[model samples]
Each structure stands twice: as structure tokens, then as C-alpha cells.
Target: MSEEKNESTKDTKNKDKSSDSKKPSRRRSVGIVLLGVLLAAILIPLGVFVVAYATYDVPEPEEVTSKQVSSIYASDAETELARIVPPEGNRRQVELEEVPEHVQNAVLAAEDREFWTNIGFSVTGFGRAVVGQLTGDGSAGGGSTITQQYVKNSLVGDDYSYVRKARELVYSVKMTNEWSKEDILAAYLNTVYLGRNAYGIEAASHAYFDKPVSELTVEEGALLAAIIQLPSQLDPWNDPVGAETRWNYVLDGMVEMGELSAEEREGMVFPETRDPAEYSAYTEATGTNGMIKNNVIAELGEVGITEEDMTTRGLQITTTIDTKTQEATLDSVEAELAGLQEDARAAVVSIEPGTGAVRSYFGGDDATGWDYANAGLQTGSTFKIFGLAAALQQGIPLSAMYDSSPVSLPGDIVVNNWDNSDSGYTTIAEALKRSYNTSFIRLQDDLYNTTQDTADMAHALGVARSLPGVPATLTENGGQPYEGIILGQYQSRAIDMSTALATVANGGVWHETHFVERVETSDGEVLYEHEVGEGERRVSELVAANLLSAMEPIAGYSSSALAEGRTSAAKTGTAQLGDTGQNKDAWMIGATPQLSTAVWVGTADNTSAIFNEWGGNMFGSNAPSAIWKSTLDGALEGQEVLEFDSPGQINFGSAPNQLYYDPVPAYTPPAYTTPAEAEPTEEEASEPEPVEEEPAPAPEVVVPEVPTPDEPEGGGIEIAPGLVIPDFLTG
Candidate 1:
């Protein structure tokens, strides 16, 4: 029985051992399955990343080419005034050795601290950028190294997309492998935008400091380095404060990077920059250059050559600007405005009436960037010619009568002469010669109550372009008619005035004014040639002749404006600056048969009185007139003088009887009154005693004659035959 019990226990023990050994094999199988799943999880993304990396083809860096510059010439196509190049790629490349060590170090410290140490890709920077994007934090950091920035800016462009970023990373690595670090740095420094239309370190140094890159000090180098981040915003000319702040940041960065010590930075100050306009390349340009260039570009566009093509293809532009006339115009204005206030500025434009060619123009004292001749100021009384023309067009003869007295309009607006004098009855010729406000207003009311006819006349005569501060829809006939329209309460350009006067000189024919006469490619291929078109007739020759006859007397009124030995017609204007009662803009517009010229004088800020002691207060007949006459004399020195034709006679019917009169008064009291008590004691009374008569019969209330509804009264004067009105008696 004992032996049987022992054998059973041993059998049970063996069975238990077998079960334990089988458990180990099952556990190994489970471990192998989990390991395979883990490997798949890691390898799938790696495979995808490797495939994406293989597909991104890095582009080869393009060789930098020197930019071609375009030359600007005067009307003769020989006198060069300036050269134009693309504002973008205007770079002056330099060797790395030519760049100061401080400049290179400053740039590296401000832009990329790990420029020399890091590989093409910065793992920490990339991770920070990824985390920032996921967290919606834009200011977290930038992931570009110096090499990456160069590759992105030069090879792939600065597009902010995931695909672009991926391409930038791939290309940056390839560029690092293909080119040396020094070569990449040289290219990067040569391609960056600085300010004032300068590109690269050398150009920037010259533009900002007026020095070469080799001569740049540590402080200047730091400032230049800072500008690469925000070129336009940090430009010293535009934002001095922002530029200084960035400059200081760059200096501090250099100190932190051990390129500059803290002690060394203590004595450093932000260097002063040069005036953006004083740059030699820009100083040689005139204010009219911008206007001329714009017109040339537009002309080029018509011939399928764009502005880009002109900049890149090295085109030569020939303008209609006569260099002699331009120099004379500029010199005359500058000389006339010399002793005046510093804020005083003047613009002059001369045009050939027959061809609508812009012969010469002076925009202002500083004429490089802004074209003041194309800008607008209030037209003042010079606009009255349009109203006069409209009346003449409607057969209202120059002999038409008007009341040159204080008058009121529909908007409680009162009109009066410049000196507050009144001419009871005056002929249209005398009214226009005197520039009487009430006369033109009444003529406009009688001929066309709405300003449409006058506006049409003005537009037809070339006052069609809209000005900056003026509403675009403003017209004499359309939109809301201003009360001061007849008196020139609108804005107009100097060129517009010149064009209008030229049209009058050209027998009432209107032509579109233009500056560019021709354009050619670098190889001398004629890209554009101006073809003169038959001008549109805007007014009758007879009406224009009559207008000229009326204007002829004005030129002789001012000796300074009178063109000696030359027949001319002119008008003067002055506009009050808002409610300040100070004259803001003064103008003189006139033309001979050969050339038309317009002159404008005002302060640059549009404030300050124009007619101070230095400048006489003769409205437009003073400084502006002198400038015009001198410019015209120089511009047309050798040109032929043409006489205006005599105006044909027109019959003016009998004068109307509707006239303005003073209302009759009803007398209530005598001139002197005596007390009843002192009447007899008259030793003290010298005058006659008043009778206690019944209130001297209320003097008959004389009601003035009221004209019929068709004939409005009290606005203008009536003309009667054989009425010889003296100039002293008239306003």
C-alpha cells in the first residue's frame, strides 16, 4: 500500500513540471507579437518622412546678374537729367573681405546667434516653431538659420507655407553641402534690403551713412544690421525712434555674443543718418522726373512694355521736357522765392499750345520725389474764365451788363468784390478784367442757373483731372453746386491750368497733355513714339477770340507779368485759406500763341500768409506773376511771337430795364427837434423850431418796381443806352 502511494505523488509532481515549462513558451510567443507591433508603429512614419524628403527637389542657386539702369533725357533726347533703376534689386555687391569684421559679427548676432555652430537645421528652433504653431502662439520663435534664410530668400522665395518651409529645409541642407559657409554669407549680405531703395550692405552703408561698407563703424554696422528685419519701418528718414530702438537692440546683442563688451557699448551712441533726399543718385533728379517717369511708363504700357520691362530691360526714355526751359523755370522760381519764408513753395508748368507737349515744369524747391505741378490747390479767381466762356458760348456778348455789387445767393452766401467796393452797372469785359465776384455770379445765374455750362467749359478746356483733397464728382453742372463756383471755389492742378490756357491759345482746340515723346529699348528699338492726334474743338473760335480780347488787358495791368514785345493774355487768382482770412494760394495763368505757362505760389504746409512784406499783396500779380513772366521770357526767348486775331463784331441788342435800386424810405422824424419849453427861450437854440404838426403825413411808402416772375430783380444792374458810367463811379 505504501509503494503505491509514493508512485502516485511522483506522477503528480512530473505533471506539474510539464505545465510550468509550457507556460514559458506561450509567454515568449506573446512577447514576439508585441515587439512586432512596436516596430511597425515606429517605422511607418519614418518611411513616410523619408519618402517626402526624397521628393523635395532642391533648386540650384541662380547666378546674380548686374541690374540694368534706364536713362532719362529731355525733349532733345540728348540732355540727361537722371537715371532710373528698380527700387528692389538696386544692390552694389562687395567681396566678403571688403565688409568690416564688425559688420559681419553684428549681423550674425542680431539675426542668427548659431550661424557658425549650428547645422543647416536647428532642432530646437524647429521644435519651438512646431509647438508654437500648435499652440497658436505666433511670437514663439523663428526656425530659420542664416543658411536657411539665404536659401529661402534666394532660391525658393519667402513664402510662408508648410510646403515652402519643407522645401526651405531641404534646400538649405543641400546648399550647405554644395557651397562653403563663407560663400553663403557673402550672397546673403549682398541680397538683403536695407532702406531708401538700397539693397545689400554696401548700398545700405552708402545710403544711410554716406560711406562705404569698409568705413562703417561698429554703431553704424549695428544699425544697418537691425534694418534687415524691417527695412521700410526702420528707415531713419521715416522712423527715427524705431530705428534707434532696433539699433540699440543689435548693439546689446553683440555684447551678449562677446563680439562687443558691455564697457565698449557704454560709450557708443546711435549714429546720425544722412538725409534721404541728399543722396547723390537722387539729388540729381528734379521733381518733374516722377511725373515724367509715370507718363513714360504709361506710354510704354500702351506699347505692351510694362514698368517691369523698362526697369529690367534697360530702356531709354525721351521726354518732351526742354532742358533749357526746365532749368529756367526752376531757377526763376527759386530766385523769386529765395528771401521769402522757408515754407514758401512754387510750381510752374509750360506747355506748347499747338501740340499739348509739356515743355518744362518745376514742381517745387525740392523736386526729386513729389510732383507739385500735378497736385491741386484752390483755383480762386482764375476759374472765373470758365464762367465767362460759358456766357460767351450762350451768345451773351462781352458787352452784357451786370451789377458788380454785394449780392446774396440761395444758401445765405453773400458775394462781394475783393475790396468790398460795388460797381452798380458794368460790362462783362470790365467785370472780368476786375474779377468782380458778384459780376461773374450774376452772369452765371442769368446764363445758366446751374453750374453745368461753366463746368462743361472748364472740363472741355482741360480741367478734367480730379485732385487729391477735392471730391472726384465735383463739377459745375453735376453733383451739388457750390455757391462759390463762379468765383473759383474748386481745386485744380497747375498743369490743368496750363492745359486750359493752352487750349484757349490754340483757337479753342483741346488736346490731352502729355510729357513722354518717345521711348526706346537698350538696343535702340523704338518701343513707343507719340503720334499727335487731331484735337477736339471745345469752343467757338469767335468766343475764344472774345475771351482772349478780354484777357489781353490783364497782362498789361501788371508790369511784372507783361511780356515785352510779345502779345499775351493772362488772369490772376487768390484764394482765402478756410476761415483764416489769409491768402493761402496765389496763381497766375497766361499764354502767348507760342507757349502757355501757369505759376502757383503757396506755403508747403498750406498755411501762412502768401502776401507778406517780402511778397507783395497784389494777389497773383506779385511773386507768381513775376515768376511766370521770367520763365516765359526764358522759355520763348528765340521762339516766334504770334498775334491773337481780332474778334468779329457781334450785335448786342438794347439793354434791359431790369435794374437793382435802393429801396425808398418812409420818413418818421425831422433832422432836428426843439423842446417846446426852449422854443421861446430860443437864445440857446440855433436851429428852426419844429412844428407840432400831425406826424408829417406818413411819407408815401414808395414801393420799388417789382419785375415779373420771368425777370428776377435785385441781383444785377440794368444798362441803358447813352449811359456813360465813369470808372470812379463803378466798383
Candidate 2:
């Protein structure tokens, strides 16, 4: 019995051992696998970091060396037109020793106080900033050191993304190791923008005070340091009020840093800055060409190339400006304005049809001055072309007649023709040749019905500016018939005017205006290439054609017509100077099949009227028109003459005069269209039976939120899809 029990116990123990062996340590195996995975994950990234750090070679601050040397060529790409002058201004490299200790301290206090002691970056400073923010100490600045800024300015010209941040960090650390702290500070001083078109402390000092940096007082140094925060706006010339406030901040920082005594800081005041325009480093580039350089820099920015990259990469920029055209435009402006007032301003801009290439530009004599060519001035009758296009789109025809009497409105305002002449019941073609303002105003009410229709049509046809409000700016998405806009009360630039006319000449296609033709590196690598874009259609081909026809007769009727055999359509405009009955703005907008030009002559202030030596306000057909003809002729001197595409054979008599809530037909049948002297039909010969004329069907009244003297008129309200209130003004 004892032997049997012992054998059973031994059998049970053997069974238990077999069960344990079958499990095969599964949990322990999983633990080992997970541990291996964790180690691999850590080791792989660590290995990558080690290899990348060891292999990474810091690039030289090539842009610093190359930024000053760049060339901008003309459309021919051979003739040098200008150089790359950064919009922030010009740089003059200087050694750190030249910068005063107080200036250095001010910069350190403003940007990075620990610039001398800290590594390339300060993680703890950032941590403290984060903690400080949580504790409501919001004034704590960022953690980027001077070396990191140098990396951003010279090495990594990219976005503030994680990858860019990582590159910046890596480059900063490498820069710290390779370059001394003094060198870093010197690089930052030479590269930093201090406004007034000044790029370095030397340039900035000269720009602000017309003095060298060695003579800068502590207050002046602090002011320069303060300007580094927002060089564009925090300048004495641009934002005097804000500039003083920022100067105070920098001075306080200097006091905190122990660089400035309390008594010294208390006595320091914002220094007076020189006239930015006169002190500009770009003043040497005077006249239209400097603006050309400024524009090219902007164009480069548009193509993802930085100013630093442009110089560092040794890029060659070719602009679309035609040399002959530009020269002729400048000469023409000089000749025509010889007898005019000295303060009179003139601007001319020409564009190629379909391509949107700018051929010639004339802004002002001072390049750093206001860009009159790009500035918005109230357009006059040259704006009528848009009204005509809009009317055509709304089903009005070129042959449609309008009441040419003076127009009266609820605001006691009256739209009158030149000399207030009333050419009653005139044909559209005749009204346009005469530039009858009342006819267009009535067309807005009785024909198109709203200002939005004309404004929309204007926008569609190349008006790059926002209208009363809703019309798409060709520059934006890139509108209407506001009567005021139809008559040229809204503002548009010469470039914008040419763009609209070019759209018409391009069979109603709108191309956004551009400057740069292409960009190439010193090594002949293509950095950027300008390709002609498929344009947005602003108006239908037929509507565009009809609008052209309406303008054709007007140009021929004027003495300011394009050069003979130019075969063009044009409109002249003269804007009234308030209630003075004299003109403030004169504009000539003309377009041929291949080119379009807008020439404007006005006073710089726009308040002073442009009167002729003959003692009258100048008209568009005078100097403005003559300039346009000269510009077009000179621009197309070698080019062959091209005729406009045939106008659409559309004769849809006039606007839908019957389609209104209370319709009073606006179309007047021509007197020549009376019944011919042919034999009458039998039904006509017989006595006609009396028939009742049925009332036309009632059309839906849009009755949009019309502008009164009380409420605001337009802000892009949608009454229905594709239907908006008048974008400019309301009746």
C-alpha cells in the first residue's frame, strides 16, 4: 500500500513538470522582445543624430558677402537696368569694435541679454519664459540668441516651422563653435535692418541722423536698437509716436542691464531722425528706376526667393520693362509737363495684352517718394469704358439711346455732362463720343439698374481694386454698375487702368500684372522662370467687343487719339476738383490689339487742380492723351501694327427695358429705322382688327439693401447666389 501511494505522488509531480515545460516562458519572452524594441528605438535615433552632427558642415555666410552684389536686367536680359536694393534698405558692414559699448548693451538688452554668456540658444530662458507667461509675466521676450538670428538671416531663409527651427538650432550651435562671439555680434550688426532703407548700424546711423555710428549717443543707440524690432514702422518718419514708446522700452532695458545709470537713463530722450526720403540709401537710385529695383525685390519674394538668397545665390533678374518704351515715356513726360505746374504729377504704365507684362512705368522723379504710378487716384471718364461693358453684359447694346439730360438724385447730387450740355435722347455711341455724364448716370438707373452691375463689370474687366465692397478685385480673386464708378469716381492706379484695358484687348481675359521675367544663378542654374498664365475671363468676348466699339469712336473724336494707323480704342477722363469746376485728375486709357497704356496727370496733392497755361483745367485729351499716344507709339515703334478682333455681331437692340417692377423703356429706336417705302402686305393694307396689348410679366424686384443717407451701403451681402448688392455705392 505505501509503495503504491509513493508511485502515484511521483506520477502527479512529473505531470505538473510537463505542464510547466509546455508553457515555454511566454511572458518572459514578450518582456525581452519589448525591451529590445525600446533599446532599438533609442539607439537608432541616437545613431542618426550622431552621424548627422558629425557629418554636417556649416555653410559660410555667403549671403553676407554676396547680398550687395546683384544685377537686375531689362526685358532683353542683357542691358543692366538696376541692382538688388533690399526694400528694408542698404547694408554697410561694420566691425563690432566700431559699435559703441552702450549700443552693444542696448542691443543685448533688447534682443538677448545673455548673448555673451549663453550658448547659441537658451533652453532654460525659454522654459522661464513659458513659466513666466503662465504666471502672468507676459513681457518676457523669446529665447533666440544673436547667433540663432544670424543663422536665420544668413543660413536658413525658411519658415518658422519645426524643420527650419531644427536647422536654425543646428546651424547656430555650429556657428558658435566656428565663429567667435565678437564675430557673431559683428555679423548681426552688419546684417540687421534698422529701417530708413538702412541694413546695418552704420547705414542706420547715417540714415537716421546723417552721421556715422562712432558719434552715436547712448539715446541714439537705444533708438537704433528699438528700431530693430520693427524697422518698417518704428521709425521717426513713419511712426514717431510709437518710435518714442519703443525707445523708452530699450532705454529701460539698458538701465536694467546695468549698462545705463538710472540718472543717465532718466535724462535720455528720443533723438531726432533725418528725413527718411532724403537720407535714404536708395536716394542714389533716384527716379523711376529705383522703384523698379524695389519692385523687383518684391517680385523675387513672390517667387519664394529671399533677398538674401538672391544675393547669396548670385541670381540675375530680368524685368519686363522695355528700354525704349521706358525712355520714351520719361521723355514724353518731361516734354509735356514743361509748361505745367511744378507740383503737377504724372504717371504712365503700359501692359502687354494677354501676358500682363509691364512694358513701361513712370512713377515720380524721386524713387523713394510716393509711387504715383501705383497709387490710386479717382478715375474719371476713362472709367466709362467699364460702364459700357457692364451695360452690354446686362443686355444693353451699343446702339441703345439714353436720356442725356442732367441726372438728379435723392442726396441732392446731380451728375452733369461736360459744360452741363444736354444732348437729349442721344445714342450710346454719340453719348460716349460726347462723354455725357447724365447719359451714363441714367443708364445706371433705367438700363443696368444698380451700381453693382457696372462695378462688377469693371472688376471683371481688370479693375484690380476692391469696389464699394463686394466686386472681386482682379488682384484679389479678381464687380458692377455703380453710377459714380461708371463716371470714374472710384480710385484706380495707372497700372490697374492698363490692366483693365489690356484685358479688353486680350479678348476679355485678365492677367495679373508682374515685373520679373526670370531668375538665373551665377552658375547658370534656373532659379525661377516666369510662365504666362491662363488668364481669368472678366467679360465675355462679345461684351468686350461691343465695349471696344463704343470706345473706338470716342478716341477718334478726340485730338488726343493714338498715333495715326495705331488702330486703337480709348477713353479720356477729367475728374472735377470738388465744387471748383476745375479738373484734379486727367486720365487717358487706350488699348491697341497688342498693347494697352494708362496715362494720368494730376497734382501730387490731388487737391490742386491741373490748369493749362491757356487758363483752363486740363482735360484728359490734352497732356494725358498725348502722353498715351507717345507711349504707345514709342513702345510699339518696331512692333507691327495689329488690328483689334472684329466686334461681336450682336445687335440685341438695348437693355431689357421691359424687365422691371415699374418699367419705362430706356431704349430709343433710331430715327433712320422708320418703315422703308416698300409696298405694304395685304393684311397691313386691310383694316387691322383692334387687339389688346398684354401687360409684360412682372419681374422679381431685387430691392436690395439700398444705401440711404442713413445706413452703410455695401459689404458683400448675398441676396442670392451670384447676385450681390452694388459693390461700390447704392442708389
Residues 630-706 of candidate 2 have per-residue lDDT tens digits of 88887788778778777766566433322111111111101111112231222221111121132122222232243
Worst 10 residues of 1 by lDDT: 722-731
TM-score of each: 0.56, 0.56
lDDT string, candidate 1, 1-731, tens digits: 89999999999999999999999999999999999888887797557556765765654433433344567789888887656666556555677888998999999987888777776778899888988989999898978888887777666788778878877787777667666778778878877778777777887888889888999999989999989888989987788999999989889899889999899999998898998777754333555565555555555565587766666555678888898788789788878788677667787889898888888877754433345576656667788888888777777788888998777654333555665568799998888777777788788887644476666677777875344333342353347445455556556678888998998898888766777788776545787888779776777777778889888878667555444588888888776543333466778899998889999887664434565334343257767888998888888888777799898654453222111111221111111112132111112211111222221211222222542111001111111121111000111
Error of model 2, residue 296, in angstroms = 2.3
Supply the TM-score for candidate 2.
Answer: 0.56
> How many backbone clashes can be found in candidate 2?
20
Q: Which runs of model 2 end up more than 4 angstroms from their true locations?
A: 1-66, 86-284, 447-449, 467-482, 653-731
Candidate 2: deviation at residue 554, Å? 2.5
